[model samples]
Target: MAGGYVVGVLTETDNLNDLARGIAAGWGMKEADIPRLAQSLGQPQLQAQLAQGLQDFSDDNATDFFVIKATGTGAQTRYRAYTAIQIWPDSAFPVTRNVAGSAAAPNTLRIFSDFQCPYCKQLWDTALPEWERQPNVYRTAHYQFPLDFHKNAFSAAEASECAGAQGKFWPYADVLFDQFSSWTRLDPKDVSGRFSTYAKTAGLDTAAFKTCLGQRTFKASVEAQYKAGVALGVRGTPTVFLNGIKLMDYRSAEEQAVVQAITSATPSAASIIDARVKSLR
Candidate 1:
């Protein structure tokens, strides 16, 4: 073992244990030998082997050979490989953030998301239904990420969070993601006016939302979300955290697989989203 720790070989096979054992056996070893092999692969002693393997290659050619390939969840995998295990000391959620069900209900599963991100929309539209259907599962919280590159992103984030002040965060988020394509296609100069129209459509007080945006009431809150992302080493849109587990590597896996990874560590909670909404109301 490398430093006396077993290295897990994660795979996509449904019969993972069996596959792992078979692979080990094929190498003329026991199932338990897999971890040892992984550890050896990472040990300092293996460096000489790697160096010898590249002895005949030029510097540039050797560098090309060492380039890491995207295996599973492309961006998510890259993010996780780089940022996992690094803890953020300063990241904190809003005190009044959405709560899960009462003591009778399950704990909250807060999600930090940016409305401008297509991946965020995908998670919302696709994987969310499975968790929503699961009893005693999770409650989601939305944090704003108006990426600097997307000119209209900040306004949408501000609008959604402003709606949170009026007890309509999720509804606002839904509308923003649902109409994201249309909303973002508008001229940047027209974003504010169109956002106001969206707020009204979501049954929110358009005037209050406008005031909140004008005063930059949620600006610091928005910055805090970005800071949390930066502190956690977020480099792209749709960076999400399930409980405290940040899913930066999200490729190759389907929605159900992703959900399973998050839910694996927590017990299912009853009607998490509905309960949180009721709590907000």
Candidate 2:
């Protein structure tokens, strides 16, 4: 147990009833009397543990729970313990070769987003201004993960990719997201035409943009990006990974979380991209 946190592991066959019976046996009590013992004890910690155990058993394979407590000399000093039965999985999204900053930058922010996601637009609005101010500190790479529910999202992703081929991906994305509501609600057949207009508005060649859209030039690549995000366990848009660490609750205080993450990250002597590539060998 580290920092007052303990992870209890159970095999696939273990059930909550078995766990309760085992606890009763440890206290030299009949299994039927466990409920009375629990009430008599009246410990919040025990109650929480029992609840978590029951939940874990119901979930069937693996689950996690957290215990938080205040400690140390200062009242604000708190310790959090994360208890889990298995190691959390890591994301396998590939390193992006295309980005706004140089590969030599120490910090890298990989954003998995969808054009039609409102939360992603909110995150973009909240985080980009601050991020652009610190251009030298970190590089930003964007990946598309259009959800299946959003009928027009996949086409929008493809449109952005096509614009990217003409060196207008970021601008096209900005316009696409800015006009999300208008395009997303339109009939599916008309969404592609709207993207062509957006491309023109972003100052791209209208004819080429229309041709690209008609041909669906980047469909495979856009689908590939979405698949990569799914493989990385991305359930929603605007999932940001900083220096390879997924930032949980980033929306609570988006800019501060991003800045703090970038600031606290340990700087290495070699470029992050180079080190990552070397480790793969």
Candidate 3:
């Protein structure tokens, strides 16, 4: 999408630059009406529906969003690539949600993940630690997005929040990702027992953590976090935003991406997004 308008689209675009050629022959609809446009372009036996609504870039008035969809055909599913030129405000990175670093830190690493997800675990086990080691460079926030198929995922997220209440969000999250195999295979009720064991490793007050978990103290907040991830166009777990530009599509996050973003003197993602937003104006 260029200048907030759908110039051209593809099922799987081979050359992104070619999309610009579309304006000379417009698709004949207001691009702002994303859903209608998306549906009309639906392919044979496949359809695109706006899965998530538009989300605000910040607390400010202007909004930036992606209209992504999953086209289903019986047992098969496909993802349609769509880009909407947009802005991101690091100031609105949801600090009050759940954070592992200083809210006011210079860089933001926002993650939406499911406890049962292997790639999420891979990111947590390797890349995340490096982000943390960079001293004052990053402020990481974790957003819960336990996919429905992962039955024990929500319970695990609630456990992490309970641990967070005791000032141990990162430590407890570490245990969950690191030891994913052991407890992930267990039933939902048994997952509670697993959380207690790791809560101890995270140095939490086990009894308090257990009580918090049992009472479902953070259930609503965890669910709300998942909803927020969806509204942000997160289609799967382990979706990350580095300085608020999505870090590749789902399951493609790599440590090298973080390394390059932090080391380069290139303008921050927020500034890049600001430029795109200005172009739309």
Question: What lDDT, from 0 to 1, does candidate 2 have?
Answer: 0.62
Clashing pairs in 3: none
Q: Which stretches of model 1 miss by more than 4 angstroms?
A: 1-108, 248-281
Per-residue CA lDDT of model 1 for 1-281, tens digit only, reads 11222112222222324433433443346666777654543444543443233112112211101111123232332100110121122144544453333323242444556777788789889865555564375555556656788877877887777888888876777788889898888887788887888889888988898998778798788887777656455556676555443454433245324444433333222123223223322
TM-score for each prediction?
A: 0.56, 0.61, 0.64
Looking at model 3, residue 132 earns an lDDT score of 80
Clashes of each: 11, 0, 0
Window of ten residues with lowest summed lDDT in model 3: 15-24
Clashes of 3: 0
Q: What pairs collide in candidate 2?
A: none
Winning model by lDDT: 3
lDDT of 1: 0.53
Between candidates 2 and 3, which one is better according to lDDT? Answer: 3
Q: Which candidate has the top score in TM-score?
A: 3
Show model 2 residue runs off by greater than 4 Å: 1-91, 95-98, 252-281
lDDT of 3 at 121: 89
Q: Sorted by TM-score, highest first, which candidate order results? A: 3, 2, 1
